[model samples]
Target: MSRSILDEAHIHPAVRSIVANNHANVIAEVKAAIASNPIVVVGMAQNPFPRKARRVLDDIKATYVYLEYGSYLSGWRPRTALKMWTGWPTFPMIFVNGILIGGANDLQRLIASGELSGLVAA
Candidate 1:
């Protein structure tokens, strides 16, 4: 199936501009928030964890940031910031409205039983 939530010729102009102009910043902000929140999940991309986590985020129309350690620590030493925020050392962190949802196993359990959708939708 299609990953897109949009229909052809029905693009919202404001959303298009926001996506184009501020995508990077938006992603960064979400990443930082995930690092800080207790209701978000963080994991590795190569791990199966992120696949389902990503699907849930997409299903709920949630915006997320997928970060590698190097990129996450690129300019301002995100490791320090992340440590201060989450106290956890990991990647592929998922956040919703700036809340942490735990890691891969946690996400899997939530997704398998459909609890993830309820939380995300809320």
Candidate 2:
């Protein structure tokens, strides 16, 4: 269940700090949202999946928070920071009760199976 990460001993000492703190502000923002909100969606602009995810949530009348980063044209560095942080390769990284439940299609499956309703009050 966990992905492999470089051990501290294997990484050069000089770059450890840089690796740890790269785009830390963005991470902090998402972390803060996760801590405070029962459901959080980390997404990027101009991505249809994120929009679809939002629409689905809207249909259920779920209370959630959404954080959007860059689009196809710009702001990718921050998005990369998120990808590295979560190890989830795509956008619309939906979190419920601070647990990442995967993206839009995943959300649809959860909804269809009636699993997501157990996590968040709709």
Candidate 3:
């Protein structure tokens, strides 16, 4: 289930370099957090969904690392880099056991179905 991306050769070399290095540091930070934590919630400021996701995790007594980017007004570029990296278009990108399990509502479904406990337990 991999997504399609433009081939490197299709992009000009100069453009390729820029794309490669675009917000690399932020991506690195996120990569480090994901590597260190089994449950990582990548979110943004002023986004209600991320907070809702956090609350859900709290109710389940799940331990997770949360990383928030810029709010609606600012920091969209840095967050865009994240969107390019993960291919998830929405905020509150929640990952469990190093795998993306979608956002808050998805999280709720997993919990309601008794799958979230198994995921965290694993």
lDDT of 1 at 120: 61
Off by over 4 Å in 3: none
lDDT winner between 1 and 3, please give it. Answer: 3
Instruction: Write the residue-wise lDDT of candidate 1 on 1-122 in tens digits.
Output: 33433453586875766434433553466566565543455444355556667776677565665554344325335444554355544554556556565665666677778877677666
Task: Report how far off residue 95 is in candidate 2 (Å).
Answer: 0.4
Cα deviation in Å at residue 102, candidate 2?
0.3
lDDT of 3: 0.90
Instruction: Report the Cα RMSD per candidate.
Output: 14.2, 1.4, 1.1
* Residue-level error in angstroms, candidate 1, position 32: 7.2
Q: Rank the candidates by lDDT, best first.
A: 2, 3, 1
Clashing pairs in 3: none
Q: For each candidate, what TM-score against the reference?
A: 0.45, 0.95, 0.94
Model 2 ranges with Cα > 4 A deviation: none
**What's the lDDT for residue 83 in model 1?**
42
Q: Best candidate per lDDT, number?
A: 2
Error of 3 at 25 (Å): 1.0
lDDT of 1 at 84: 39
